[model samples]
Target: MITKWEVLSLIWASGVAYTAPRILNRWSLITTCDPIELCQGCRDERRYVMQEGMTYEVMGAAGGPLQVLVEAFAWYLKPFLPALRRAAGRPPLPTCSKGSCLAHTSTRRRA
Candidate 1:
């Protein structure tokens, strides 16, 4: 049989555990800037490092694995995102269905 205090404690603990990641991630984003704008060939690398660091810190504080596999997969893809974005010329977003949108989508979707 669980006491009221234990139930309350568990609720609070779960809330903190759930909310902690969002708080930490927001803080991490606030602390870091776009690497490309700050450093040459460094944005992707820096972003990855920051992401890894942030994940490590949050997981460490949470005292449990929090989306570790997902984060790790994301980290693996981090380095390629910028390149992927740039390889197609770093085109602007599809505000309208223009050539840029089609070109970007087709290129990426191609085998």
Candidate 2:
């Protein structure tokens, strides 16, 4: 048998336990950034680190160990995302139609 006060206390404790780490992590990131003196590389690195950290925190909070592992694996592949996007954005290979190649047709028109 559980009392209402016991349930409330458990809820409060869980909330604090979850929230304190997030707050501290955010504070650490904020304090490390020196807006005026930071270089572009430093800023980019910091941003990436912060994003990865936040991703882990959110994912860990939302699910069990397997979900956290999956999220981390996905996050590890994030750097390849831009390259994948660029490759996806490219036009399809030229196809021949009516004795004229599509690539050749476009080049001839541009000349």
Instruction: Give me the candidate number with maximum lDDT.
Output: 2
| Model 2 agreement with the true structure over 1-111: per-residue lDDT tens digits | 999999977776666556555444433543365633444443454465566666567656554343334434444345686667678996433222313333323335546
Clashing pairs in 1: none
**Per-candidate TM-score against the hidden true structure:** 0.31, 0.32
For model 2, the superposed segments whose C-alpha errors exceed 4 Å read 35-111
What's the distance in Å from true for residue 69, model 2? Answer: 28
What global local distance difference test value does model 2 have? 0.49
In candidate 1, what residue range of length 10 has the lowest lDDT sum?
92-101
lDDT of 2 at 3: 100
lDDT of 1 by residue, 1-111 (tens): 999999977776666566556544533442354433333223443455466666678557553345433343343355587678788898532222323333223334542
lDDT of each: 0.48, 0.49
Q: What does candidate 2 score on TM?
A: 0.32
